[model samples]
Target: MYQYDGFDQEFVRQRSAQFRDQVKRRLSGALSEAEFKPLRLMNGVYLELHAYLLRVAIPYGTLSSQQLKRLAMIGRKWDRGYGHFTTRQNIQFNWPKLEDIPDMLDSLAEVEMHAIQTSGACIRNVTADQFSGVAKDEIEDPRPWAEIIRQWSSLHPEFTFLPRKFKVSITGSSEDRAAIKVHDIGLALKKNDHGDIGFEVMVGGGQGRTPMLAQTIRDFLPKSEILPYLEAIMRVYNQFGRRDNKYKARIKILVHETGIEKLRSLVEAEYEALRASFIDLPQAEVSRIQNFFTAPPYQNLEDQEALLNQQAQQNTGFGQWLQANRTGHKQPGYAVVTISLKPIGGIPGDISSDQMDYVADLSERYGFGEIRVTHEQNLVLPDIRQDQLFDLYQDLVSQGLATANAGLISDIISCPGMDYCALATARSIPIAQALSRRFEDITSQQNIGPLKIKISGCINACGHHHVGHIGILGLERKGEEHYQLSLGGHAGFEASIGKIVGPSFKEHQIVDAVETVVQTYLDLRTEDEIFLDTYRRLGDTPFKEALYAAA
Candidate 1:
């Protein structure tokens, strides 16, 4: 993990001091609510349904055990006893008092974390794949580039206020686990035929009221030119992106209205002019940032396959967990383990202070002293030794953190809908909870196989509902909550937006509707086909017919 230098540390501390004075003035009636709105948003504070919400950035979803403990302590001291991990790889404290937030910011600064750029219409937190350096199929780690972008974009005077919020993601593997295609700017690191590394840059991908996949603005950009090229893209968007309507302000809308070809020409012209400017980062600076992400020391050990196999044979529970929650690691004798935050009928990403403390302890004890937050709303111990799996699993089970459902139907991604969000229309947590209970049987879930169910409370797409294998959107209709279902959506390579099946259902009928959709896939799928593949081959006819016929 990247430790904060003196510059970074001092920067955060000064920001905290500034915000503390602002908060004091607001409390003393020197600043009205309207006057304080933008100031509070710049510091990542939001007025939610019942109380203020504070979102803290977890850069590229990387956290040290020490940082994790501080977060747990802050949650315990200031607000409720738990915090919600969000889809953007950030954490939200939903019940903080207005007067206590400055203290929270100071506490976070002590741990090298902050709430800046988490809200308002500026560049948000830069996210990358959770399995970045450790995944077996990785080409290179993307976190270095993400960190470079983070340094460049933080409160840049030129882009302090854009037409709408922008997002950027990077991935270094052939498999796109970061959902790069759905971001405002997506970078896939690749090597050319000459064996030199560069980036495949895509722009204008987002999901809200309008869903669109990013288009390839540049087939290949040299690694040295990433920052300058990004500046060019931003310049183009700022000049042409809509400012009259918030609904049409995202870059995705601009790309749609202007067409990809014309947009590419405009961006290319800007890039040519900016190629000789100071925005082009030097290679030495890039290497300086890359040094922070070098691999941790590892002991040479043989693969623990024999011991793992024996343990699985001895315990059925261990066998199920190995099947569902474990993934292959780049190094032999090591494994990546996903700690399921979504226990059956539990909130998708809520972790209590006690649980966070325990996970932090285990990270130091059993694995490297590092933790990762996934876009799927789960925590990861990224470098667990295979020989110590049994002991870790035992302790995790004791803490109510061991649910052997990582990619199954029970591992749902849901937003804080009407329960906490002021912009939501319906309750997303209950719908997700009901669906989890409906599929609680382990055997049935394994049978269904590799399904993603993403639910959003409204059309803001905070839950990433547009990319799930089975997407559910909750809408308000005539004073009642109605749910709509969509199919064939996915977030990996060749990302596609889901298509709606038909009419909306009442709240009580959604679980059954999802079951019908799953059953239809099971009936129509060929050998070893997943839900998305089956839907693509057969189209929506079968699932739609089954859903409507039963209704």
Candidate 2:
């Protein structure tokens, strides 16, 4: 994790002090709600349907035990007893009092964290692959670049107020765990024929009312030129992106209106013009940033495959969790342990303060004192030893966090929906909870194979429903909650948007409709075919017929 230097610390403390005064002025009737809206938003505070929501950025989804403990403390003291880990790998405290937010910000500053750019039409938190440095297949750790982006974009005067909010995601692995295709700017770190590292730049990808996969603008851009290239893109968008209507403000819209080739030309022209004066980061500065993310000291331990198999043979629950929650790490004896937040019948991505404390403790004890938040709404202990898997599983089980449902139907990705967001049309969490309970059987889920079921309360696509294998969008139809199901959406390397299967189903019928789709897949799939493979191979015809046959 990147530690905050003197300048970083002072910058955050000043922002906190400024926001504290702003809150005081608002409370003193010196500023109206309308007058204070943008200010509050700039500080990552939102006035939701029920109360204020505070979103704290977890840069590249990395957190130290100390930072995690501080977040737990903030959740316990200032807001509700739990925080919602979002799709962007940030945490949201949904029930915070406006008056206490400044204090919360101050507390966060103490741990080198803040909520800046979390909300507002600015470059939000720069997300990266959760398993950045530890992934065995990574070309290079993307977090250093993510951190560089963070430093460059934070409070950049030119991009502080763009046409709309922008997001950038990077991944060093070929597997695309960061969902780069759906971001405003997506970068894939790769080595070219000459073995020099660079980025494959893609632009104009987003999900909302208009969902589109990002198109590659530059097949290969030197890693050293990322900042200036990004600046050029932002400059182009800032100059010509739609500003009259907030609906068509994202860079994705601009990319759609302006042809991709034309946009690329414009960006290239801008980049060439700016290259002379932009003064890119020196090699020394790059090294300084990279030093922060160097690998932790590892013991000369052998792989624990034999011990793990023996332990799994002894404990069924541990075995199930081991099969589902563990990812291969680059280190021989270590594994990346994903702690599923989406327990069956529980809210997705919501973690209690005590659970956070427990996870912090577990991370410090069993692994490196580091934790990571995934885009799929799960927490990770990135360097857990394989030999200590059973003990860690037992500890997670004690805290009710040992759900072996990673990438399963019950491991849903959903937003707060109508329960909190004023913009939502229907409740999302309830639908997720209902679907989770519907597929609560672990055996059934594993047998069904890897499936992503993303739900959104509205067209905003906060839950990333547009990319799920079985995407469900909750909507309001004639004063009743209804859901429209889509099939074959994927967020992997071969990213594609799902297609709507049929007419919307009422709330009562949605879960059953989903089950029908799943059963249809199970019935028609060949050997070892996952839901996505089946859907792609068979297309939407069979699923559509199955979903609406009776109707």
Candidate 3:
């Protein structure tokens, strides 16, 4: 992880001091609540339902062991004994006193972390694949670029107060674990014919009251022009994006309203005119940032295929876990391990302070002394030794983190919903819980194959329901909670927005509807076809027909 430089240290210090004074003024009655609301929001403090929620950005979801320990300490000393990991790969504190926010910021700054840009209508945390550095298919680690964006967008005078919030996600892998297609700006790293690494920029993708897949603004942009290109896109949106109506404000809306070709032209015009004037990013600066993420050294250990096979023969549970949680790594013998936070009936991404400390310790003991938060709302011990997999698995099991459902149907990604969110219309956690409980059988879940069941309390799509294989959007109908199902949405290499199947279902019927879809897929799939493949091949006709069938 990147250590904070002098400039970084000073910036955070000054900001914290300024915010401390701001808090004092607000408490002393000099700054009224009305005047203080925006200031607090800009500092990443929000007056959420029931209490104040402070969202702290874990940039690119990479954190050092010390940082993790600091988080554990924060959770232990303050508000709640746990923190909620969000789909954007950030962490949130559900209960923080309003008066103590400045002190909280100071503590975060001690670890080179902060709440800046985690809230309000500005560029939010830059997210990326959880296994950015270790993914076997990655052309290059995306964190250096993500860090650059963090510094560039931090308190940017031009964009700090935009019409609406903006989010950017990047991925260096071919598999697209970062869900780049569903973000305001998505960057996919690629190598052209000449074998030079760069990015394929996707613009105008988002999910909210309206959802639209991003379109390629540039098929390939050289590494040097990334910042300039991003500036161009932001400039275009800030100038012309709708401000009169909040619903029509995202870059996605503007792209749809003006047509992608026109939007592309406008961004290009901005790029051409402003590229020269933009600050020249130093190569050494990028290299300095890259130094923080250089791959760790590993001994040339022999592959453990035979040992793993023997263990699998001895324990079916271990075999199931290996199949679900283990992922290929670029190194010869290490594996990327996803510790599922979504245990049956447990909160989607809430990890207790003790669990956080344990995870941090485990990362140092078995994996690298580093951790990552995925867009799916899971944590990753990205550089685990292959030989120690079983021990690590056992440790995780003790904490109920060993769910063995990484990409399986039971491992659903859901938001806080009506339980904690002020904007929610229905309860998402209970629905997620019911569905996961229904699919508790690992064999059945694996038999059903790779399925993403994402749920959101509202159209904001915080849970990324718009891209799930089976998307569930909760809504209220006539004072009763209901869920509308969407089928065939994908957030992989071939990204597509999920479409609503038909009418919404009652809260009780929603889980049944999901089961119906799964059973329908099991029957309809030809052979080894996942839910997504089957849905795309046959379209929604079969599934929709099956879903609405009388029980």
Candidate 4:
């Protein structure tokens, strides 16, 4: 939770005022729709399939109670009574009127939030692990670096308009919760053999019409050089990345066309030049930013192992939630509670205004008055005391926020497909909902184990379908919605893109197809093997055969 300083405040205010004027001109016909299109996009407003969608960035997916409440208010006041959280860990107001967006932006500014860089072909939101500082396994918190990038990239004149959009994701832990490998630039924070912190820098990782995992450009870059090196990479891309074709404009394409060795050489040369110009961030400035992400105070209490075991014996529901929705925290007697938004047959990541307000209240009372949005489209109370788990679960259950399926088969990651996005080729939400219902049994889900089902409506891969254990990509075959299945995709320390199984299935047949694939894995899997591990061991032959057997 980096609070906005005076400079930050004033900058947002001026930007808001400028946007307000731009919007006014567009509405008054002083600016034509053609001229207003890019301007509105730069501010995170999009003309969607049925209405305007306003995407608000939740920086590194962190939110204070006040910020969460403000998002709830914006959802209630400007658009429909709910907002759609996306795979990028941002929230989207799906029904906002064009005229009301400026007001929405102003309201967001008041909460140190905004829609800037959430859309268009500029540096988008810099994301990190939702459990950054709280994760027990993390080497260092990654948000400070993410924040540094956010500040540097925000309206940077040099990178204001690139050939294509760029994304950067960071992870502080060995586990790749942030999916760093699939970003335009991925930074993994780690300690070297000498106990000095640095980054494992990867570049050219992306998914779209073409999917490729990022390759390591530097094994261990000194922490002090992150910004300058990033600038160098961007400079290389901006100067040489293709501008003639939108389809191939991304840096991923540039990296593909030019080998990683050459790209690394180019970036290193640029970095060497920039490092001499006093452009690297000073150690003092880095320390100042790092101070904001320091851990919160916690009472020295005994571990909750016995208490949790006792509670599990008493309440079946709380027991299930605790098993699936909780992750160990850095502090003893505390846990990071994931509030799953993907309830069976519910719209994935769609939180109603009332639910948002209640969660905000719960964050203040039970946690640290802070919330986190995960890339998997869930909310997290990162600092919840283990002693209060029962009470929090009951409250979340009442609000329809307790699903007990955080990383289970039912916890699907999906995008707003043809239902909202004009770029989508098919419907994604209904597919997600159907699959959730198909696997609604909690026992069955637990039996299936940590399965990730990510769906995208098209090849743009907004749902991160490329990285799911069982990836589903929705496309229109002829005139009907069809889903093409993929297997063995994973997003972790060992990241890999899923491989296509066989022909696409029709909309109605997709649920059954997924079940067939899962059942195949269950039959063939060794003891304790999850869907991904089984797939990796067995490959696509078994799943593909089972998937097309019914056809």
Which candidate wins on lDDT?
Answer: 2
* Candidate 1 lDDT score at position 345: 96
lDDT (Cα, 0-100) at 508 in candidate 2: 88
Tens digit of per-residue lDDT, candidate 4, span 279-398? 667788788888898888888876798899899889888888999999999898899999999999999999999999999999999987999999999999999899999899999988
Q: For each candidate, give its TM-score against the true structure.
A: 0.98, 0.99, 0.98, 0.99
Q: Which pairs clash (backbone N, Cα, C closer than 3 Å) in model 2?
A: none
Better of 2 and 4 by TM-score: 2
Model 4 scores a C-alpha lDDT of 0.91
Overall lDDT per candidate, in order of appearance: 0.92, 0.94, 0.89, 0.91
Which residue pairs does candidate 4 place in steric collision? none
lDDT of 4 at 354: 92
Off by over 4 Å in 3: none
The residue-by-residue lDDT of candidate 1 on 1-551, one tens digit each, is: 78889999999999999999999999999999999998899889999999999999998899999999999999999978899999989999999998999999999999999998998888889999999899999988999999999988888777868899999999998799889999999999998999988999999999998989999999899888888888889989888999999989999999999999999999999989987765557778788889999987877777898899899999988878888999889988899999999999999999999999999999999888999999899999999999999999999999999899999999999999999999999999999999999999877898899999999999999999999999999999999999989888899768999999999999999999999999888899899998889999999998888988765
**How far out, in Å, is residue 21 in model 3?**
1.7
**TM-score attained by model 4:** 0.99
lDDT of 2: 0.94
Q: What is the lDDT of residue 331 in candidate 3?
A: 88
